[model samples]
Target: MTTDQSSPISPYLTFDKKEWAKLRAETPMTLDARDLERLSGVIERVSEQEVIEVYLPLSRLLNFYVGASQALHAATSRFLGQSENKTPFIIGIAGSVAVGKSTTARVLQALLSRWTNSPRVDLVPTDGFLLPNAVLEERGIMNRKGFPESFDTRALLHFLAEVKAGRPQVKAPVYSHFHYDVLPDKTITVDRPDILIVEGLNLLQPAKLPSNGEAIPFVSDFFDFSIYIDADPELIGQWYVERFMRLRKTAFRDPAAYFYRYSKLSDDEAQATARHIWETINLANLKANILPTRQRARLILEKVQDHTVQTVHLRKI
Candidate 1:
């Protein structure tokens, strides 16, 4: 397959899907349809064909990177005459909502765990780090939900730090879409895995400097590798609405669902609400925060319509 020369050359080396697929030769296919179905999110379509063509190669590449990291760590330890704790290789997956980042992270977790070098892989989504609904309401940023400000940035940083420091058990807060809030008393304990995948909307964002010029740490700083899923804003907006409608028919039908009211709405009314939410909140967040961080990712997956990745951009070393 020919490269898209119209795309500007940069620090990134771009490859279309056909060329990228060629790199997957000899990588074992360990996942089946049942695994893909379980990994996929509501309304998200991750086909086996797509997995073979895209994720298999990506997983193999990650395996090589992880192996190299372990080797380097060992060499450093030998030179220092002291054993360093084995830190997890953290991978950050960032993108707009409805861009299928969660699905990508899940698929990677499954694929990477199957590797002999990295047998234990954990996926922690940043949604769990989002401030509770009450906090957003008190801060008067309820309308700005999903924006970077809606998250507990300090808490997220601390959590990642502990994980990278090789903490035995790092507890992460849990968020429930059904309840539309962070579960106060509950937490997900992440043991020191061989690999950790952190997925969220703004994982690739830069740090916000203080007025006094104090340096702040970014979530991306903890990432050994990062991926940004990209698509046209218009397509993402449409996908958001489509996913909303699907949820209205499925999850919203539950009486305890946060969006239960949407399930009762007429089809047209539901569509309107979805469009309004996308345009006012999600789209705004994408433009202001998420999209700007695409260039910061180590890898970029540019998706076309039907939620398929057409090009893969790998940052040059």
Candidate 2:
């Protein structure tokens, strides 16, 4: 079911682009054209105006949140008579594929890092936690690549747990888009940071309660704040197809690329294949896992056909 952005009883305070832009107040725009171009996805478009209006306000809000959290930690440490250890403020960005979650995460990372309160902000994509292609194939779930069951959940949970515990250094497996798989030898080492942004398709998904009442930790358990990117599925599907077509002339042309075979296909054949994949795989994942978790986000950014955010829904505290 679609959310009622206009409902009086809604948990969120909805704001249109203009109303939301007013919230920016005095937050300065720190990103440039080169920064946006470098951080954007293959086919995603981000404008400086979007940053000034939408993201600056967001960075300002997060700066307040981080400051509050830090103060709270210091007070609690003093109360307990213990040395204070820095706990990273974890932010999660969840969305459907082709809905610009990566761009949002990267943009936020840049903005948050620029803030005096959160100069050290790290962004981690959950693609790295996905099961290796070999393991997925062995389990006969290769087609369900982005599904919750397709991830190394235990490993991801352990990493998050350690990070939240104020570990000095944590390592995450690295995945390669060109190879379309996790690299066995490569890992991204994350040092202690003031803020950590975790982005993924299923970050907000809740785990089923065990019949025996055993404790089960979900990925969302570590998130101090979460954002959901929302758009009509039809628009997302169109964007996915457009991105696929564009990849055919770029990334797919590299002989070392996993999708190189797709480069040889005609434009008509490529579009058909992209749509089929969307209908059978990506759309299914969105419906079954991603969309249902939208309300769990502390904030939701609703996008229009052109990929510009049209509405902002901030959950009432």
Candidate 3:
């Protein structure tokens, strides 16, 4: 005899995306508008009702999880009878490029910081861990930039180790989107944050040592919780093109922008360039690496082509 104990939870029983939209529309807007504006860097024009319905409950859920994680940590410390140390509650957010992981991380950091305990929340991106273009060229990996092998894995791992050990003034390298490169010697010192949200394309990667035979744990090993943003490939591709079109009129016009050449391109020319990048780089990385790691996430937020979340898939117990 065997037993089966797993099934979907939530009132979600429909395949239609409108179900969420309708539900969100019906819910009263309780979350303050100013609250959201201050919490998020990118003030996306999401409907007020959606926050009241969907995100408010989600925020409450995450708060509970964070509190539980802290309680568990304290219990472990008591068992060891060690001196009190504050280890930041680390969360890993993993998703494909252009899948809104950055947006999600920013929103969560802002909301979590405003909770009753009002812990200090810091958001960091793993793009800063990317090797310099010069270094990538030296290793002949300039073309395969966002792949797992392109990162300084050991350095990233060590940084997380020190942060988890509650070391004071832990510094992380900074990456600039305008420059499209890691800023040399510029570091963000994290001073004992109550929560650290690490957002990246490949944070859920599995550890694999070379045939040279060494064993090493992955960065995901340090995460107390992890979430994977999910969306269809076609939707992400469209969003990439749209975002590129928007940037063509904004950042691309800057003389120092890495994409300054795009500022001069016609609309069609810019779209073509964006398509080429999606096909050659971002999409390829998504299919080959990022999508596979969804299996490792503790929770998955599945989205529809309209970019609103449809349903959430929690890992089976």
Top candidate when judged by TM-score against the true structure: 2
lDDT tens digits, residue span 1-317, model 3: 01212333432232233333443333334447776565443223454554554465556666777788778878998999986798888889999888888877877776677666536998889999999989999999887889998899888999999999999999899998898889997998888888899999999989777787787779999998898998899988888888888888988899999989999999999999999999899899999999999868877778777666766655545
Lowest summed lDDT window (length 10), candidate 1: 1-10
Q: What overall lDDT goes with each candidate model?
A: 0.92, 0.92, 0.78
| Rank ordering of all candidates by TM-score, starting from the highest | 2, 1, 3
Q: Which pairs of residues collide in model 3?
A: none
Give me the runs in candidate 3 sitting further than 4 Å from their true place.
1-31, 34-44, 209-215
List runs of model 2 lying over 4 Å from the truth: 1-8
lDDT of 3 at 205: 85
**C-alpha lDDT (0 to 100) for residue 146 of candidate 2:** 97
Query: Which residue pairs come into collision in candidate 1?
Result: none
Q: Write the per-residue lDDT of candidate 2 for residues 37-94, one digit (tens) a residue.
A: 8878888777898898889988999899999999999999999999999999999999
